[model samples]
Target: MAWSRDEIARRIASDIPDGWTVNIGVGIPTLVPRYIPQGREVVFHSENGILGMVPLREDESPDPEVIDAGKNAVSIRFGGSFFDSSVSFAMIRGGHIDLGIVGALQVSQNGDLSNWSTNERMIGGIGGAADVCSGVKQLWVAMMHTAENGTRKLLTDCTFPLTAVSVVCRVYSDLAVLERDERKWKVVTLSPGTDLLEVRNATGFPIDI
Candidate 1:
């Protein structure tokens, strides 16, 4: 069976080092905080100046002022703080973030990222992606393995405009966990019932198991 969005987030959460500060990009990556391992200390950072973001409780009313970078209502953990975007960006650009988990439209075997836009139209204006990709010690992509048309998103070369080159260290897709070593892409884990052959056939690029 393929992993669900929440399962993918859990998988990514398991790989994050304890005590690391992580910037959770919008979309699927935003779900990561809910699945982080118990007893572990991980600080969630938002590009919009939120630090230590936690999941909102169902019974509690959401504060309109407390939101993540995606503008979704959220809660804050103990010691969480808020600041201006400039300060938020400084944390992102100054290499203070330990890990960055982001979504992608396409990722090349060479670790090229193209997530922000397709064609010439700007989608969401590439908010903080460039800085996050470059500033984090490790960058991981969390997204579906294929496009809506069933076209493989893991490719030999990205057709979309590149957001950053060779910055992706790992990818946690619904089907597998892939890592880039130098110039080679390898499958480090597979979803239940998925095999190396399936992964090879699903990807547009050659992959080592």
Candidate 2:
């Protein structure tokens, strides 16, 4: 079976080291915090200005005031702090964040990312993605391997407008986890019941197993 969205998030969370500050992008990335191992410290940063964001409890009511970059209601951890967008952007631009977990529309073989916009809805949507991708020490993408129509999103090059160039260090897709190794895409791990052949077929570029 392919890795479910929650499973992919869990995989990414398990890979994150303790005590690292992370920025979670929209989509599947929002699921990361719920899977973080207990006793581990992962400082989650939201572009809107929250530094200690947590997913709302299952039965817990959302605080209309507390939300994430996606504007979804979330709770805050005890040590969490809130700031204005200016300070938040400063933190992002200053590269204080250790890891940035983002969702992608496409990721090129060279690690180029195109996530903020597409030709269809091109007016606005360029949020802090550009700054986060460019400034973060490491950027990990969590997304589906292909579009709903089965088109590959892991391409030799991105067709959509670029968010930032060559910034994606790793990708956690429904099918597998691929990492940049020696300037080439390498299969780090495959989803349960997912084989190399399936991943190879799903990827748009050559991948080293």
TM-scores, all models, native as reference = 0.96, 0.95
Which one is best on lDDT?
A: 2
* Candidate 1 per-residue lDDT over residues 72-167, each given as its tens digit: 999988999999999998998898999999999999988999999988777888788989998888999999999889998888899999889999
The Cα local distance difference test for each model comes to 0.91, 0.92
**Alpha carbon deviation, residue 197, candidate 2 (Å):** 1.5
Which segments of candidate 2 are over 4 A away from where they belong?
Answer: 58-61
Per-residue CA lDDT of model 2 for 1-209, tens digit only, reads 89999999999999999999999998899999999999999999999999988888889898888989888999888999999999999999898999999999999998999997776876358888999999888999999999999999999999999999999999999999999954698889998899999999999999988
Candidate 1 contains a number of clashing pairs equal to 0
